[model samples]
Target: MRKIPKPTLIAKDVFLECISTVGNLLLKQNYEKCQDLVEAAAQDFDNKFPLLEIYQIPRNLTVLGSIGKEEMKSVYTYRMVKDGMPGNTFYNTLKNSAPYGKCPLCSVRFVETLDHYLPKSLYPILSVVPVNLIPSCSSCNTGKKISFPTNSIEQTFHPYYDDIQDESWIKATLLPYDPFGFNYFVECPDSWEQIKKDRANNHFSSFKLNTLFTAHANEEFRGAKDHMKTLFNLHPDELIKHLDGAFRSRRDQLGINSWQAVMYYCLLKDNWFVQGGVLTF
Candidate 1:
Protein backbone atom coordinates (compact mmCIF):
# COMPACT_ATOMS: atom_id res chain seq x y z
CA MET A 1 0.00 0.00 0.00
CA ARG A 2 1.15 3.57 -0.65
CA LYS A 3 1.06 6.62 1.58
CA ILE A 4 -2.14 8.32 0.43
CA PRO A 5 -2.27 12.09 0.46
CA LYS A 6 -5.07 13.00 2.81
CA PRO A 7 -7.76 14.77 0.83
CA THR A 8 -8.86 18.14 2.12
CA LEU A 9 -12.07 18.07 4.13
CA ILE A 10 -13.60 20.36 1.54
CA ALA A 11 -12.69 18.00 -1.28
CA LYS A 12 -14.19 15.14 0.65
CA ASP A 13 -17.31 17.20 1.18
CA VAL A 14 -17.46 17.86 -2.53
CA PHE A 15 -17.42 14.16 -3.11
CA LEU A 16 -20.13 13.66 -0.53
CA GLU A 17 -22.27 16.33 -2.15
CA CYS A 18 -22.06 14.51 -5.45
CA ILE A 19 -22.93 11.24 -3.84
CA SER A 20 -25.88 12.78 -2.00
CA THR A 21 -27.17 14.36 -5.14
CA VAL A 22 -27.12 11.03 -6.85
CA GLY A 23 -28.73 9.42 -3.86
CA ASN A 24 -31.47 12.03 -3.85
CA LEU A 25 -32.05 11.58 -7.55
CA LEU A 26 -32.56 7.89 -7.07
CA LEU A 27 -34.68 8.00 -3.91
CA LYS A 28 -37.12 10.68 -4.93
CA GLN A 29 -39.88 9.52 -2.61
CA ASN A 30 -39.33 12.54 -0.39
CA TYR A 31 -37.29 15.45 -1.72
CA GLU A 32 -36.92 17.22 1.63
CA LYS A 33 -35.79 14.06 3.45
CA CYS A 34 -33.32 13.11 0.75
CA GLN A 35 -31.65 16.49 1.18
CA ASP A 36 -31.37 15.87 4.90
CA LEU A 37 -29.82 12.42 4.51
CA VAL A 38 -27.12 13.85 2.28
CA GLU A 39 -26.43 16.51 4.88
CA ALA A 40 -26.20 13.93 7.65
CA ALA A 41 -23.77 11.63 5.82
CA ALA A 42 -21.54 14.62 5.13
CA GLN A 43 -21.56 15.58 8.79
CA ASP A 44 -20.93 12.03 9.94
CA PHE A 45 -17.99 11.45 7.61
CA ASP A 46 -16.57 14.85 8.55
CA ASN A 47 -16.96 14.51 12.32
CA LYS A 48 -14.84 11.36 12.18
CA PHE A 49 -11.93 13.25 10.66
CA PRO A 50 -10.00 15.61 12.95
CA LEU A 51 -8.54 18.89 11.62
CA LEU A 52 -11.43 19.13 9.17
CA GLU A 53 -14.31 21.56 9.26
CA ILE A 54 -17.77 20.19 9.77
CA TYR A 55 -19.83 21.44 6.88
CA GLN A 56 -23.18 22.93 7.83
CA ILE A 57 -26.38 21.87 6.19
CA PRO A 58 -29.82 23.53 6.01
CA ARG A 59 -31.53 21.04 8.33
CA ASN A 60 -30.56 18.14 10.58
CA LEU A 61 -33.01 15.56 9.30
CA THR A 62 -31.93 12.55 7.23
CA VAL A 63 -34.53 11.27 4.76
CA LEU A 64 -32.81 9.14 2.19
CA GLY A 65 -31.39 5.87 3.49
CA SER A 66 -29.84 4.18 0.49
CA ILE A 67 -28.66 4.69 -3.06
CA GLY A 68 -31.38 3.84 -5.55
CA LYS A 69 -30.64 1.65 -8.55
CA GLU A 70 -31.40 4.54 -10.88
CA GLU A 71 -28.33 6.37 -9.61
CA MET A 72 -26.07 3.33 -9.89
CA LYS A 73 -27.15 2.68 -13.47
CA SER A 74 -26.56 6.31 -14.41
CA VAL A 75 -23.29 6.78 -16.28
CA TYR A 76 -20.72 9.05 -14.68
CA THR A 77 -17.01 9.27 -15.52
CA TYR A 78 -14.07 11.70 -15.03
CA ARG A 79 -11.73 13.53 -17.37
CA MET A 80 -9.46 10.52 -17.80
CA VAL A 81 -12.34 8.17 -18.46
CA LYS A 82 -15.17 8.19 -20.96
CA ASP A 83 -18.05 8.26 -18.48
CA GLY A 84 -17.63 11.72 -16.80
CA MET A 85 -17.56 13.42 -12.73
CA PRO A 86 -18.58 10.68 -10.41
CA GLY A 87 -16.84 7.85 -12.21
CA ASN A 88 -13.69 9.85 -12.91
CA THR A 89 -13.39 11.19 -9.38
CA PHE A 90 -13.97 7.73 -7.97
CA TYR A 91 -11.29 6.25 -10.21
CA ASN A 92 -8.76 9.01 -9.50
CA THR A 93 -9.35 8.81 -5.75
CA LEU A 94 -8.83 5.03 -5.75
CA LYS A 95 -5.82 5.35 -8.04
CA ASN A 96 -4.32 7.74 -5.50
CA SER A 97 -4.75 5.03 -2.87
CA ALA A 98 -2.77 2.42 -4.81
CA PRO A 99 1.00 2.04 -5.09
CA TYR A 100 1.46 3.58 -8.51
CA GLY A 101 -1.92 2.10 -9.42
CA LYS A 102 -0.50 -1.32 -8.67
CA CYS A 103 -2.83 -3.73 -6.94
CA PRO A 104 -2.16 -3.97 -3.21
CA LEU A 105 -3.13 -7.64 -3.35
CA CYS A 106 -0.99 -8.89 -6.23
CA SER A 107 1.25 -5.84 -6.64
CA VAL A 108 0.39 -6.08 -10.28
CA ARG A 109 -0.19 -2.91 -12.31
CA PHE A 110 -3.46 -3.63 -14.05
CA VAL A 111 -6.94 -2.20 -14.40
CA GLU A 112 -8.19 -1.81 -10.85
CA THR A 113 -11.57 -1.29 -9.18
CA LEU A 114 -13.04 0.44 -6.15
CA ASP A 115 -13.28 -2.24 -3.47
CA HIS A 116 -15.66 -1.96 -0.57
CA TYR A 117 -13.94 -2.84 2.69
CA LEU A 118 -17.30 -4.13 3.78
CA PRO A 119 -18.34 -5.96 0.69
CA LYS A 120 -21.03 -4.06 -1.22
CA SER A 121 -22.65 -7.32 -2.15
CA LEU A 122 -23.53 -7.79 1.50
CA TYR A 123 -23.94 -4.15 2.48
CA PRO A 124 -24.85 -2.33 -0.67
CA ILE A 125 -25.63 0.89 1.17
CA LEU A 126 -21.98 1.30 2.18
CA SER A 127 -20.81 1.16 -1.41
CA VAL A 128 -20.32 4.93 -1.52
CA VAL A 129 -18.83 5.51 1.91
CA PRO A 130 -15.55 7.13 0.88
CA VAL A 131 -13.63 5.57 3.72
CA ASN A 132 -15.02 2.14 2.92
CA LEU A 133 -13.90 2.20 -0.68
CA ILE A 134 -10.37 1.18 -1.67
CA PRO A 135 -8.55 0.90 -4.95
CA SER A 136 -7.51 -2.69 -5.55
CA CYS A 137 -5.70 -4.42 -8.36
CA SER A 138 -7.82 -6.77 -10.44
CA SER A 139 -6.49 -10.05 -9.10
CA CYS A 140 -7.03 -9.19 -5.46
CA ASN A 141 -10.37 -7.55 -6.09
CA THR A 142 -11.73 -10.41 -8.17
CA GLY A 143 -9.81 -13.42 -6.93
CA LYS A 144 -9.09 -13.01 -3.24
CA LYS A 145 -10.82 -10.52 -0.91
CA ILE A 146 -14.26 -10.50 -2.43
CA SER A 147 -16.79 -10.00 0.39
CA PHE A 148 -14.50 -11.43 3.07
CA PRO A 149 -13.70 -9.85 6.41
CA THR A 150 -10.48 -11.53 7.56
CA ASN A 151 -10.02 -9.88 10.95
CA SER A 152 -11.28 -7.33 13.40
CA ILE A 153 -10.54 -3.61 13.09
CA GLU A 154 -7.71 -3.79 15.62
CA GLN A 155 -6.02 -6.58 13.76
CA THR A 156 -6.14 -5.21 10.23
CA PHE A 157 -4.68 -2.10 8.66
CA HIS A 158 -7.19 0.56 7.72
CA PRO A 159 -5.87 2.32 4.67
CA TYR A 160 -7.51 5.57 5.78
CA TYR A 161 -6.16 5.62 9.33
CA ASP A 162 -3.24 3.25 9.64
CA ASP A 163 0.23 4.47 8.71
CA ILE A 164 1.88 1.61 6.84
CA GLN A 165 5.11 3.50 6.19
CA ASP A 166 7.13 1.54 8.72
CA GLU A 167 8.78 -1.87 8.96
CA SER A 168 6.46 -2.73 11.82
CA TRP A 169 3.55 -2.73 9.39
CA ILE A 170 5.02 -6.10 8.34
CA LYS A 171 7.79 -8.33 9.65
CA ALA A 172 9.78 -10.25 7.06
CA THR A 173 11.69 -13.46 7.75
CA LEU A 174 14.06 -14.84 5.14
CA LEU A 175 13.58 -18.52 4.51
CA PRO A 176 16.38 -21.08 4.48
CA TYR A 177 17.42 -22.45 1.08
CA ASP A 178 13.96 -23.57 0.11
CA PRO A 179 12.85 -25.86 -2.67
CA PHE A 180 9.80 -23.88 -3.78
CA GLY A 181 11.75 -20.60 -3.81
CA PHE A 182 8.92 -19.23 -1.71
CA ASN A 183 11.56 -17.20 0.07
CA TYR A 184 9.96 -15.34 2.98
CA PHE A 185 6.97 -15.25 5.26
CA VAL A 186 5.88 -11.82 6.49
CA GLU A 187 4.28 -11.67 9.89
CA CYS A 188 3.15 -8.91 12.14
CA PRO A 189 5.11 -8.71 15.45
CA ASP A 190 4.48 -11.56 17.89
CA SER A 191 2.39 -9.34 20.11
CA TRP A 192 0.16 -8.57 17.13
CA GLU A 193 0.39 -12.09 15.62
CA GLN A 194 -2.41 -14.09 17.17
CA ILE A 195 -4.96 -11.40 16.57
CA LYS A 196 -3.57 -10.36 13.22
CA LYS A 197 -2.76 -13.73 11.69
CA ASP A 198 -5.87 -14.02 9.58
CA ARG A 199 -5.55 -10.47 8.33
CA ALA A 200 -1.85 -10.95 7.63
CA ASN A 201 -2.49 -14.14 5.77
CA ASN A 202 -5.19 -12.49 3.75
CA HIS A 203 -2.93 -9.57 2.94
CA PHE A 204 0.07 -11.68 1.96
CA SER A 205 -1.74 -14.36 0.03
CA SER A 206 -4.15 -12.01 -1.66
CA PHE A 207 -1.52 -9.47 -2.72
CA LYS A 208 1.20 -12.04 -3.29
CA LEU A 209 3.63 -9.51 -1.84
CA ASN A 210 5.48 -12.36 -0.13
CA THR A 211 6.29 -13.78 -3.54
CA LEU A 212 9.23 -13.72 -5.94
CA PHE A 213 9.29 -9.99 -6.76
CA THR A 214 9.49 -8.78 -3.17
CA ALA A 215 11.97 -11.50 -2.26
CA HIS A 216 14.21 -10.74 -5.18
CA ALA A 217 14.24 -7.09 -4.22
CA ASN A 218 14.92 -7.91 -0.61
CA GLU A 219 17.86 -10.12 -1.62
CA GLU A 220 19.21 -7.56 -4.07
CA PHE A 221 19.21 -4.93 -1.34
CA ARG A 222 21.08 -7.07 1.22
CA GLY A 223 23.38 -8.77 -1.31
CA ALA A 224 22.23 -12.10 0.07
CA LYS A 225 20.00 -15.01 -0.71
CA ASP A 226 17.56 -14.15 2.05
CA HIS A 227 16.86 -11.72 4.90
CA MET A 228 18.78 -13.82 7.46
CA LYS A 229 21.93 -13.80 5.36
CA THR A 230 21.74 -10.03 5.10
CA LEU A 231 20.97 -9.56 8.79
CA PHE A 232 23.58 -11.93 10.23
CA ASN A 233 26.41 -10.96 7.90
CA LEU A 234 25.92 -7.20 7.58
CA HIS A 235 27.16 -4.64 10.11
CA PRO A 236 24.76 -2.12 11.58
CA ASP A 237 26.53 0.76 9.85
CA GLU A 238 26.49 -1.10 6.53
CA LEU A 239 22.80 -1.76 6.90
CA ILE A 240 22.14 1.87 7.73
CA LYS A 241 24.08 3.10 4.72
CA HIS A 242 22.36 0.82 2.27
CA LEU A 243 18.86 1.41 3.60
CA ASP A 244 19.47 5.16 3.75
CA GLY A 245 20.73 5.27 0.18
CA ALA A 246 17.89 3.10 -1.02
CA PHE A 247 15.31 5.37 0.57
CA ARG A 248 16.89 8.53 -0.83
CA SER A 249 17.33 6.99 -4.25
CA ARG A 250 13.62 6.08 -4.42
CA ARG A 251 12.34 9.61 -3.69
CA ASP A 252 13.65 10.74 -7.08
CA GLN A 253 13.08 7.47 -8.88
CA LEU A 254 9.42 6.89 -7.96
CA GLY A 255 8.28 10.48 -8.56
CA ILE A 256 7.72 12.56 -5.44
CA ASN A 257 3.95 13.18 -5.64
CA SER A 258 3.19 9.52 -6.11
CA TRP A 259 1.80 8.26 -2.77
CA GLN A 260 3.23 4.74 -3.08
CA ALA A 261 6.69 6.14 -3.73
CA VAL A 262 6.38 8.35 -0.70
CA MET A 263 5.35 5.40 1.49
CA TYR A 264 8.18 3.16 0.33
CA TYR A 265 10.60 6.02 1.03
CA CYS A 266 9.16 6.66 4.49
CA LEU A 267 9.52 2.98 5.38
CA LEU A 268 13.16 3.14 4.36
CA LYS A 269 13.77 6.28 6.40
CA ASP A 270 12.10 4.88 9.50
CA ASN A 271 14.02 1.61 9.21
CA TRP A 272 17.43 3.31 9.29
CA PHE A 273 16.61 6.14 11.68
CA VAL A 274 15.53 3.59 14.28
CA GLN A 275 19.00 2.07 13.99
CA GLY A 276 20.76 5.33 15.03
CA GLY A 277 21.06 7.04 11.66
CA VAL A 278 20.91 10.82 11.91
CA LEU A 279 18.50 12.99 9.97
CA THR A 280 20.53 15.64 8.14
CA PHE A 281 17.62 18.00 7.78
Candidate 2:
Protein backbone atom coordinates (compact mmCIF):
# COMPACT_ATOMS: atom_id res chain seq x y z
CA MET A 1 0.00 0.00 0.00
CA ARG A 2 1.32 3.41 -0.89
CA LYS A 3 1.55 5.82 2.04
CA ILE A 4 -0.08 9.17 1.54
CA PRO A 5 1.30 12.30 3.14
CA LYS A 6 -0.63 13.99 5.90
CA PRO A 7 -3.41 16.24 4.65
CA THR A 8 -3.67 19.89 5.55
CA LEU A 9 -6.99 20.96 6.98
CA ILE A 10 -7.43 22.84 3.71
CA ALA A 11 -11.18 22.70 3.76
CA LYS A 12 -11.17 24.38 7.12
CA ASP A 13 -14.53 26.13 6.87
CA VAL A 14 -16.36 23.09 5.53
CA PHE A 15 -14.55 20.78 7.90
CA LEU A 16 -15.25 22.89 10.94
CA GLU A 17 -18.83 23.52 10.02
CA CYS A 18 -19.52 19.86 9.40
CA ILE A 19 -17.71 18.82 12.55
CA SER A 20 -19.73 21.29 14.62
CA THR A 21 -23.01 20.26 13.09
CA VAL A 22 -22.30 16.58 13.52
CA GLY A 23 -20.95 17.06 17.03
CA ASN A 24 -24.12 18.72 18.17
CA LEU A 25 -26.24 15.97 16.65
CA LEU A 26 -24.30 13.35 18.54
CA LEU A 27 -24.63 15.39 21.74
CA LYS A 28 -28.34 15.73 21.21
CA GLN A 29 -28.60 12.08 20.11
CA ASN A 30 -29.85 13.30 16.77
CA TYR A 31 -28.31 10.48 14.76
CA GLU A 32 -30.30 11.22 11.61
CA LYS A 33 -29.02 14.77 11.61
CA CYS A 34 -25.50 13.55 12.19
CA GLN A 35 -25.83 11.25 9.20
CA ASP A 36 -27.02 14.11 7.00
CA LEU A 37 -24.05 16.26 8.00
CA VAL A 38 -21.81 13.37 7.14
CA GLU A 39 -23.45 12.97 3.75
CA ALA A 40 -22.71 16.58 3.03
CA ALA A 41 -19.08 16.18 3.94
CA ALA A 42 -18.78 13.10 1.74
CA GLN A 43 -20.40 15.01 -1.11
CA ASP A 44 -17.77 17.72 -0.81
CA PHE A 45 -15.17 15.25 -2.04
CA ASP A 46 -17.44 13.44 -4.50
CA ASN A 47 -19.55 10.40 -3.62
CA LYS A 48 -16.73 8.66 -1.80
CA PHE A 49 -18.10 7.63 1.57
CA PRO A 50 -19.94 4.46 0.53
CA LEU A 51 -18.30 2.25 3.15
CA LEU A 52 -19.44 4.69 5.79
CA GLU A 53 -22.66 2.76 6.06
CA ILE A 54 -20.94 0.08 8.12
CA TYR A 55 -19.44 2.47 10.64
CA GLN A 56 -22.54 4.60 11.24
CA ILE A 57 -24.60 2.34 13.45
CA PRO A 58 -21.63 0.79 15.17
CA ARG A 59 -20.14 4.22 15.78
CA ASN A 60 -23.35 5.64 17.14
CA LEU A 61 -24.00 2.59 19.29
CA THR A 62 -20.47 2.65 20.62
CA VAL A 63 -20.80 6.34 21.47
CA LEU A 64 -23.97 5.68 23.42
CA GLY A 65 -22.27 2.93 25.40
CA SER A 66 -19.24 5.01 26.31
CA ILE A 67 -20.75 8.38 27.33
CA GLY A 68 -20.69 7.65 31.03
CA LYS A 69 -17.52 5.62 31.24
CA GLU A 70 -14.34 7.23 32.51
CA GLU A 71 -11.08 6.28 30.78
CA MET A 72 -11.84 5.75 27.10
CA LYS A 73 -15.09 7.63 27.24
CA SER A 74 -13.78 10.92 26.00
CA VAL A 75 -11.51 9.28 23.56
CA TYR A 76 -14.40 7.46 21.92
CA THR A 77 -16.78 10.39 22.22
CA TYR A 78 -14.29 12.80 20.78
CA ARG A 79 -13.71 10.33 17.99
CA MET A 80 -17.43 10.09 17.35
CA VAL A 81 -18.10 13.81 17.40
CA LYS A 82 -14.83 14.76 15.81
CA ASP A 83 -15.14 12.07 13.18
CA GLY A 84 -18.93 11.88 13.04
CA MET A 85 -20.14 10.08 9.87
CA PRO A 86 -17.91 11.92 7.46
CA GLY A 87 -15.42 13.28 9.96
CA ASN A 88 -12.92 10.45 10.37
CA THR A 89 -14.25 7.83 7.98
CA PHE A 90 -15.11 10.17 5.12
CA TYR A 91 -12.00 12.28 5.30
CA ASN A 92 -9.77 9.28 5.55
CA THR A 93 -11.52 7.73 2.56
CA LEU A 94 -11.20 10.96 0.62
CA LYS A 95 -7.47 11.01 1.16
CA ASN A 96 -7.18 7.39 0.17
CA SER A 97 -9.31 7.79 -2.96
CA ALA A 98 -6.84 10.12 -4.58
CA PRO A 99 -4.52 8.67 -7.21
CA TYR A 100 -1.84 9.30 -4.65
CA GLY A 101 -2.88 6.75 -2.03
CA LYS A 102 -2.99 3.50 -3.97
CA CYS A 103 -2.51 -0.12 -3.15
CA PRO A 104 0.64 -1.57 -4.68
CA LEU A 105 -0.93 -5.01 -4.66
CA CYS A 106 -3.97 -4.18 -6.76
CA SER A 107 -2.86 -0.75 -7.95
CA VAL A 108 -6.28 0.87 -7.52
CA ARG A 109 -6.57 4.49 -6.44
CA PHE A 110 -8.95 4.74 -3.51
CA VAL A 111 -10.14 6.78 -0.52
CA GLU A 112 -11.52 5.37 2.79
CA THR A 113 -12.12 1.71 1.94
CA LEU A 114 -8.54 0.78 2.82
CA ASP A 115 -8.14 -2.23 5.02
CA HIS A 116 -6.73 -1.42 8.45
CA TYR A 117 -3.29 -2.91 9.07
CA LEU A 118 -5.04 -4.84 11.73
CA PRO A 119 -8.43 -5.31 10.19
CA LYS A 120 -11.00 -2.91 11.63
CA SER A 121 -13.26 -5.92 11.49
CA LEU A 122 -11.06 -7.23 14.29
CA TYR A 123 -10.70 -3.93 16.11
CA PRO A 124 -13.92 -2.19 15.19
CA ILE A 125 -13.71 -0.09 18.31
CA LEU A 126 -10.67 1.77 16.99
CA SER A 127 -12.05 2.10 13.47
CA VAL A 128 -12.29 5.87 13.57
CA VAL A 129 -8.92 6.56 15.17
CA PRO A 130 -6.58 8.21 12.67
CA VAL A 131 -3.85 5.81 13.68
CA ASN A 132 -5.99 2.85 12.68
CA LEU A 133 -6.95 4.10 9.25
CA ILE A 134 -4.89 2.96 6.23
CA PRO A 135 -5.42 4.02 2.61
CA SER A 136 -5.29 1.06 0.22
CA CYS A 137 -6.89 -0.09 -3.02
CA SER A 138 -10.28 -1.79 -2.88
CA SER A 139 -8.95 -5.06 -4.28
CA CYS A 140 -6.29 -5.08 -1.59
CA ASN A 141 -9.00 -4.11 0.83
CA THR A 142 -11.53 -6.77 -0.23
CA GLY A 143 -9.75 -9.55 -2.17
CA LYS A 144 -7.22 -9.94 0.60
CA LYS A 145 -6.93 -8.69 4.20
CA ILE A 146 -10.24 -10.07 5.34
CA SER A 147 -9.98 -9.58 9.11
CA PHE A 148 -6.32 -10.58 9.33
CA PRO A 149 -4.22 -9.63 12.36
CA THR A 150 -0.52 -8.96 12.97
CA ASN A 151 0.70 -10.19 16.33
CA SER A 152 4.29 -9.10 15.80
CA ILE A 153 3.43 -5.43 15.96
CA GLU A 154 0.30 -4.83 17.92
CA GLN A 155 -0.24 -1.92 15.56
CA THR A 156 0.46 -1.44 11.87
CA PHE A 157 1.95 1.68 10.37
CA HIS A 158 -0.32 4.69 10.53
CA PRO A 159 -0.08 6.53 7.23
CA TYR A 160 -0.13 9.79 9.20
CA TYR A 161 2.13 8.77 12.09
CA ASP A 162 4.65 6.07 11.19
CA ASP A 163 7.65 6.85 9.06
CA ILE A 164 7.22 3.90 6.68
CA GLN A 165 10.29 5.32 4.95
CA ASP A 166 12.32 2.98 7.17
CA GLU A 167 10.65 -0.21 5.97
CA SER A 168 11.56 -2.24 2.85
CA TRP A 169 7.99 -3.23 2.10
CA ILE A 170 8.31 -3.58 -1.67
CA LYS A 171 11.53 -5.56 -1.29
CA ALA A 172 9.43 -8.67 -1.64
CA THR A 173 10.02 -10.75 -4.73
CA LEU A 174 7.32 -11.36 -7.30
CA LEU A 175 6.84 -15.05 -7.84
CA PRO A 176 5.56 -16.94 -10.92
CA TYR A 177 2.01 -16.85 -12.33
CA ASP A 178 0.49 -17.43 -8.93
CA PRO A 179 -2.59 -15.29 -9.75
CA PHE A 180 -1.75 -13.39 -6.59
CA GLY A 181 1.63 -12.11 -7.70
CA PHE A 182 1.34 -9.22 -5.31
CA ASN A 183 1.99 -11.75 -2.57
CA TYR A 184 5.26 -10.57 -1.00
CA PHE A 185 7.06 -13.10 1.15
CA VAL A 186 10.49 -12.59 2.61
CA GLU A 187 13.05 -14.27 4.82
CA CYS A 188 13.29 -12.29 8.00
CA PRO A 189 16.53 -11.30 9.70
CA ASP A 190 17.34 -13.47 12.70
CA SER A 191 16.59 -10.62 15.07
CA TRP A 192 13.02 -10.33 13.77
CA GLU A 193 12.64 -13.94 12.69
CA GLN A 194 9.34 -15.24 13.96
CA ILE A 195 7.55 -11.94 13.94
CA LYS A 196 8.67 -11.08 10.45
CA LYS A 197 7.90 -14.56 9.24
CA ASP A 198 4.44 -14.43 10.66
CA ARG A 199 3.91 -11.02 9.23
CA ALA A 200 5.16 -12.12 5.83
CA ASN A 201 3.10 -15.26 5.72
CA ASN A 202 0.00 -13.47 6.88
CA HIS A 203 0.57 -10.68 4.40
CA PHE A 204 1.27 -13.11 1.59
CA SER A 205 -1.68 -15.39 2.14
CA SER A 206 -4.32 -13.09 3.49
CA PHE A 207 -3.64 -10.12 1.24
CA LYS A 208 -3.45 -12.47 -1.76
CA LEU A 209 -0.31 -10.63 -2.72
CA ASN A 210 0.79 -13.97 -4.18
CA THR A 211 -2.14 -14.24 -6.53
CA LEU A 212 -0.85 -14.16 -10.10
CA PHE A 213 -4.07 -12.80 -11.56
CA THR A 214 -5.49 -9.76 -9.84
CA ALA A 215 -7.94 -7.01 -10.67
CA HIS A 216 -4.94 -4.73 -11.07
CA ALA A 217 -3.59 -6.99 -13.82
CA ASN A 218 -6.35 -5.87 -16.16
CA GLU A 219 -6.44 -2.30 -14.95
CA GLU A 220 -3.64 -0.08 -13.61
CA PHE A 221 -0.55 -2.28 -13.86
CA ARG A 222 -1.22 -3.62 -17.34
CA GLY A 223 1.42 -1.40 -18.84
CA ALA A 224 3.91 -2.00 -16.06
CA LYS A 225 3.37 -5.72 -16.43
CA ASP A 226 3.89 -5.61 -20.18
CA HIS A 227 7.04 -3.58 -19.64
CA MET A 228 8.28 -6.05 -17.05
CA LYS A 229 7.52 -8.93 -19.36
CA THR A 230 9.63 -7.43 -22.11
CA LEU A 231 12.45 -6.81 -19.64
CA PHE A 232 12.11 -10.33 -18.25
CA ASN A 233 12.79 -11.81 -21.69
CA LEU A 234 16.13 -10.02 -21.77
CA HIS A 235 19.39 -11.13 -20.14
CA PRO A 236 20.04 -10.04 -16.56
CA ASP A 237 22.32 -7.17 -17.55
CA GLU A 238 19.89 -5.97 -20.23
CA LEU A 239 16.96 -6.33 -17.85
CA ILE A 240 18.75 -4.22 -15.27
CA LYS A 241 19.42 -1.44 -17.76
CA HIS A 242 15.87 -1.60 -19.08
CA LEU A 243 14.28 -1.60 -15.67
CA ASP A 244 16.49 1.23 -14.43
CA GLY A 245 15.51 3.35 -17.40
CA ALA A 246 11.89 2.43 -17.00
CA PHE A 247 11.79 3.33 -13.33
CA ARG A 248 13.56 6.57 -14.10
CA SER A 249 11.04 7.37 -16.80
CA ARG A 250 8.17 6.64 -14.42
CA ARG A 251 9.63 9.02 -11.88
CA ASP A 252 10.17 11.68 -14.47
CA GLN A 253 6.62 11.41 -15.72
CA LEU A 254 4.96 11.08 -12.32
CA GLY A 255 7.08 13.20 -10.06
CA ILE A 256 5.49 12.57 -6.71
CA ASN A 257 1.98 13.47 -7.75
CA SER A 258 0.56 12.10 -4.49
CA TRP A 259 2.03 11.41 -1.09
CA GLN A 260 1.16 7.72 -1.17
CA ALA A 261 2.64 7.02 -4.59
CA VAL A 262 5.71 9.07 -3.78
CA MET A 263 6.40 7.10 -0.62
CA TYR A 264 5.91 3.78 -2.42
CA TYR A 265 8.23 4.76 -5.25
CA CYS A 266 10.75 6.06 -2.77
CA LEU A 267 10.72 2.74 -0.95
CA LEU A 268 11.25 0.91 -4.22
CA LYS A 269 14.09 3.21 -5.17
CA ASP A 270 15.81 2.81 -1.83
CA ASN A 271 15.19 -0.85 -1.17
CA TRP A 272 15.00 -2.50 -4.58
CA PHE A 273 15.93 -0.53 -7.68
CA VAL A 274 19.05 1.25 -6.35
CA GLN A 275 20.17 -1.11 -3.62
CA GLY A 276 22.92 -2.47 -5.87
CA GLY A 277 20.46 -5.01 -7.20
CA VAL A 278 19.68 -6.09 -10.77
CA LEU A 279 18.38 -2.62 -11.58
CA THR A 280 20.87 0.22 -11.75
CA PHE A 281 20.80 3.83 -12.85
| Per-residue lDDT of 177 in model 2 | 40
lDDT of 2: 0.40
Tens-place lDDT digits, model 1, residues 161-188: 5444443434333222332122334445
Could you tell me the TM-score of candidate 2?
Answer: 0.45
Say which candidate scores most in lDDT: 1
Q: Could you give the C-alpha RMSD of every candidate to the true structure, in order shown?
A: 9.8, 11.1
Off by over 4 Å in 1: 9-82, 97-99, 104-111, 150-155, 169-180, 190-198, 211-281
Please, what are the lDDT tens digits per residue for candidate 2 over residues 1-281?
34455444333332333344434545535333333333343333222122212223223223223232231233323533354544555545444444555554333344435454434343333333333345566666666643533233322233443332333433333323434233233334455545444544455456554343233332334345455445545654554565566555644544322222333343244334323332221
Residue range with the least summed lDDT across 10 consecutive positions in model 1:
53-62
Instruction: Count steric clashes of candidate 2.
Output: 21
* Per-candidate local distance difference test: 0.44, 0.40
Tell me, by TM-score, which candidate is best: 1
